[model samples]
Target chain A: MTKKQLKNLALQSYTKDLLDQKKVESVARLLTRFQLKQYIRELRNSESQKTINIVLPHLPAKTDQQMLSRLFAGKRIIYHVDKTLLLGIKIIDNDQVYDLNLKDTLDNLFTFVSSGYD
Target chain B: MIDSQKIIEQLENRLMSFGVDKKTQNMGVVEKITDGVVIASGLSKCFMGEIVAFGNGNYGTVLNLDEDTVSIILLGKEGKLKEGDGIKRTGKLLSIDVADTILGRVIDPLGSPLDARPKIKGARAMPLERIAAGVVEREPVNTPLKTGLKAIDAIIPIGRGQRELIIGDRGLGKTAIAIDTIINQRVSNDVICVYVAIGQKQSTIAQIIDRLKEEQALPYTVVVVASSSDPASLQYLAPYAGCAIAEYFMEKGKDALVIYDDLTKHAWAYRQLSLVLRRPAGREAYPGDIFYLHSRLLERAVKLNKKHKGGSITALPIIETQANDISAYIPTNVISITDGQIYLEPDLFYSGIRPAVNVGRSVSRVGGAAQTSAIKSVSGKLRLELAQYRELAVFAQFGSELDATTMALLERGKRTTEILKQLQYQPLKESLQILSIWSVTNGFLDDIPVESTQRFEKEYHEFVSSRNPKLLETLETGEKPSEPTVTQMEKITREFKKIFSF
Candidate 1:
C-alpha cells in the first residue's frame, strides 16, 4: 500500500478525540509489522495534539481549573505545579512550549550575558 | 573599556520598559546518539543546514530529514547528551562572524577565538556555504599572484582569483610552498590571507602561526583551524569557514587569498559524517555528493568585475595523494575542479629539490597572460627549452656522443634547474626572479659551472643592486625592457663575468 494510504488509515483510527480500541485493532491487523509501528506513532501524535499541558508555580483553585477546561472546551487540559517556575505559567503543546515566568526570563538573560564572553 | 554610566542608564531604561513577548520555537527530542550525530524526532519543521541549539548550550546543524526523524551533526565536543534530550531550532543558518578584527586571529569553524585572544565583536555574519558569484558578476583573471618561486613564477604562473591545486605526496613541502606564498604577499600588501588548517596537528598549526608572526605576515592573515582532535563536523566546516572570511574582504573590494592546507582530510571527515548518518556511499565509501563538497567551495574563488567593486579571492587548495597516485577518487575530483595544479613529486623532493614542483606536469590554465611583461619577454621560451632538455637528458644518460647543439641545450638546462632550486622562506622579488631566469635563458650562464650557479645567481643580484640600482629599478617596473636596459644588462654581465671566479 502507498504511504499516503497508511497515513490516512492511522488518522482514521481515532474517534471523538481519542483512540477507538476496536478501530485500532482492525487497522493493526491490516498493516504489516513495520507499518503498524508508524501507524501507532501517528496515532499517538494525533492524540497528543488534543491535550495541552500547563505547568504553574502552584496549584490553581477549582474555579481556575474549570475556567481552563472551559477555554479548551473538548480538548484535554492537564495542570501541574513546580516551585522552580517562581511566578507565572508554562504551556507545553507536545514538542513546542509557551514559557512565561520569571525563572525562564532570568535564565534567558543569563545565557545572553554569558554568551557574550565566549 | 565599557562605559559605566551608559550601562547604568540602559539598565534603568530596560527596567522601566521591558516586556516579555511571545517567543515560539519548534523543538525536538533526541532519539539516538551516534558518535557526533544526533537523531531526533519531532523536528518536522526543521530545515536542512539550520542551526539547532541543545538545552545544555551545545549546537548542531540539521543534515538530513526523513519521514519520521532528522539527523543532525553536532558542531562541537559532545555535550554529554543522552536519548530523550531536547533541542530547539535557532532560526539561523550556519555562518561565521567576520570583520576586520578577524584578520591575524586564529579561530575555529564557529568563529570562536582559538588563540586565547579577546573575542571579536561587531562582526557581520557571513554564511559558511554561499552560492558562488555567477558568470555575469565575474571577470576573467588577468593579474599575477606570484609565489616568488622561480619555476612557478616563470613557468606555471597563478592568477588572482584562480583555483590552483597543490597536489603531492606527504612531507613534500606543499605547505611550505603555501606559506611562502602567504609570506610573499607581504611585498604587495594588497591581499588579505586566510589559512585554513583542517585535521592538522595543533603543534604544527601553532608552529605555522609562529612563523607567520615572525615574518610579520600574521598582521594580514587569518588562521582558521579545525584540528584533528576537533569533531568531524568542524573539520568538514573548516574550508568553508575560511572561504567565508575571505569572501568578506572580497565583497569589500579587497583582494583575498585562502589556502586550504589539505582537503584530503576534509573528504575523510565528510565521509565519516555521511556513514554515521547512514547515507549511501560510493567509491572509497565517500558520499555521492563528494565532488559537490569541493566544487561549491572552490567555485567561491572568483574575481568580481569592476561594477562589483573589482575584488577577487585567489584559492590555493592543497591535496595530499597516497604514494603519488593522482587518479585516486578525491584527488582526481579536485584536480578536475581546480583551474590547474602544481604537481609536487617525492622523487624530486628526495633528490634535494626543495619545493619539488614538477614543471612538466604542473600547469597554470591562466597561462602567461597572468605574468608581467618583463618576466614574459625573458622567460617566454623557458618552458619549451626545459621540456627539450629533459627529453635529451635521457638520451645523454646512455653516454653516446651527441651534436654540439644538444650539449649546449643540456648545459643551459642544468644551470636553469640549479638556479630554480630556492631555499625555504626565501622568496625573491619579481625583478630578481626575472634577472636569474634571464641570465640562464639568454645563454649568459652557459660557461658558468652548474655547481657555482647558485653562488653566481646570488652574487649577481647583489652586484646589480649595489652597482647599478637604477637598472634593477627599471626591471622592477614590470614593463618590457627598453633597448638601453638590454644594453646595460649585457655590459654589467660582461663586467661581472671578469670579476667573478668559479
Candidate 2:
C-alpha cells in the first residue's frame, strides 16, 4: 500500500520468522522497539495509496516463498522481466541493487568485436 | 685516603670490559679528595663532561667527563663521585633517531614530532650525516619549474629537477621566493614540497608557518626545522633529514621539491661537531669531508628514468653571501655543485626591486624548456631593455645628453623593477597583479604615470577579480595575453591613472 506499510510488514515478518526459527531470543532486545512500533503505526496509517513500479530483464531463480522470506529478512526488493536481460535476473531496491544477467556480461563484447573474433 | 693500587685496578678492569685499548688510554689523578676521584687527560679531550653509571643497572652517556687526571675521557655523573673515583671508558659515540614517518610532518632538530601528532609510522631511520647523491646516477635537469615570477620566469627560469642555489645577503627575499614556489605547487597535486630551515630564528620559522597556513600550503608541505637554538648535532642533521624524507616520495615516482632555507649554518654546525668529535680539520677549520658532505646531499636530488618511478627532487639551496661575495669558499663550493643560481643583488634590492634578482648574473641552467610562450616572448625584450637601462641610467646620472632611446630604456627599467617589487611574503596566486603590470609595461597602458603604479596594480586586480579570474591562471601558464584580457587590463590602468592623478 504505502512505502511505510511495506517497510513495517517486511520488518514484522522478518522478526516473526527469526522468532519462529529460534534465531533470536527476543526481537525487543535485538532492535529498537519504540522505533519499530512507530514505524508500524505510520505504515498502518499510510497504507492506502502508495505503490512502486520496477523493471527487470528476467525473473529470478528463487520461488515466491523464498522471495517473501528474503523480503521479510530486511531485503528491500523489486523485480520484472525483459528479454533484454537475456536469461539472467536483476533486482533493484532502496540503495541496494543486484544484477546477475547476460546483458551486463555482453557489454564488454565490443573489445572482442573489434578484434574480429567472437 | 684511598689506595692508588685499588683505584688503578678498578679503572683497568672497567676499561678492559668497555673495549678500550690501553695504548689509546692514558690516566692521571686529579685532587684525591675524600669525596671522589676527578681525572683529566689529553685522550679525554672530546669526551669531557660525559658521565657513565654502572653496577646499579642504569647506563647513561657521560655528560661531564673530566680529562685532567685520566688519559681517557672521564665518565661519571656530576654528584655521583665519592673519594676513590674509578674511571671507565665507553667507546660508543652518540647517535640520532631517523625514521620514515618523519616526512610530510614538521619536526624539531632532535627528530621529535612538532605537529603534536603521534610518532611517525615508518620504521627505518638513519643518522643525519648521510652521503650526497652520486654523480653517475643523477640525470641532468631538463624539466622546468615555473615560479610564476615574470622577471625570473622570463629571464632566469628554474627547471623542474634543477638544483638552483639562491644566494643573497640576509634580510633579502631568498626564503620568500622559495616559500612562494611552494605555494604555487598547491594547485598541482603532483608536486610535493619540503622546506628545511637550518639555523634560522624560531620566530621566523613561526612566521613562515603562519604564511603557509594563510595560503593553505601546509597540507602538501613538510617542514624540517633545525633552528639556531638547536644542538649542533641537530643543525648538522637538518638537511640530510630533509633529503631522506624527500627520498621516500621520490621512490614513489612522484615529483618533489625541497628547499634548504640556508646551508651555511648547517656547514658551520657540522664543522663544529666534527672538531668536537676529533675529526681532522681542513680549510677554514672545517672537516676534510666538507665538500663530500655537500656533494652527497645534492646528489640525492635526481629525476628518475621511466622504468623506475618517474620522480624528481628539485633542490633550492639558499646561501647567504657576506658583502655579496660569491667567491667565498662555501658559496663557490655550493655554486659548483648546483645546476645554476638565482643571484639577488643588495644594490638592486635597495633600489626598490623586491626580489632584487640580478638578471645579468643570475642564470637557470635548464629552465629554457619550462618557459611559457608568453614569458619567452616578453622576457627576450625585457632583459635587453633592462641591460641598456642600467648603462643609460648610469650615464643619465652623469649629466650627459640623453637620447629618446635611453629615456625609453630608463622608463622600461623602472617599470620592470616596479613589476617585480612584490610585497614580502605574499603568495604567488597574487601574480595576476604582476601580469597586469606586465601588460602596462608592454605599451598596453604606457600613459600611466610613475606614482600611479600601486594604485593601477590594485585596480587592475580588482577588475580581473570581478570579470574573468581564469585569465590569471592562463597568464601564469605563459599563454599570450588574450585580446579581451589585454583590453580589460588597459581600461582599468587608464581609469586608475585618471583617478590617482586627480
User: Number of the top candidate by TM-score?
Assistant: 1
Q: Which lDDT value does model 1 have at B158?
A: 92
lDDT of each candidate versus the true structure: 0.90, 0.63
The regions of model 1 sitting more than 4 angstroms off are A1-47, A60-74, B1-22
Best by DockQ: 1
Binned by DockQ into CAPRI classes (incorrect, acceptable, medium, high), candidate 1 is acceptable
Model 1 scores a TM of 0.92
Query: Over the stretch A1-118, how does candidate 1's per-residue lDDT look in tens digits?
Result: 7767777887888787677999999888888888887787677767667888999999999998998889778888888889999998888777777788888888776665555554
TM-score of each: 0.92, 0.62
Task: Tell me the TM-score of chain B in each candidate.
Answer: 0.97, 0.75
Q: What is the lDDT of candidate 2?
A: 0.63
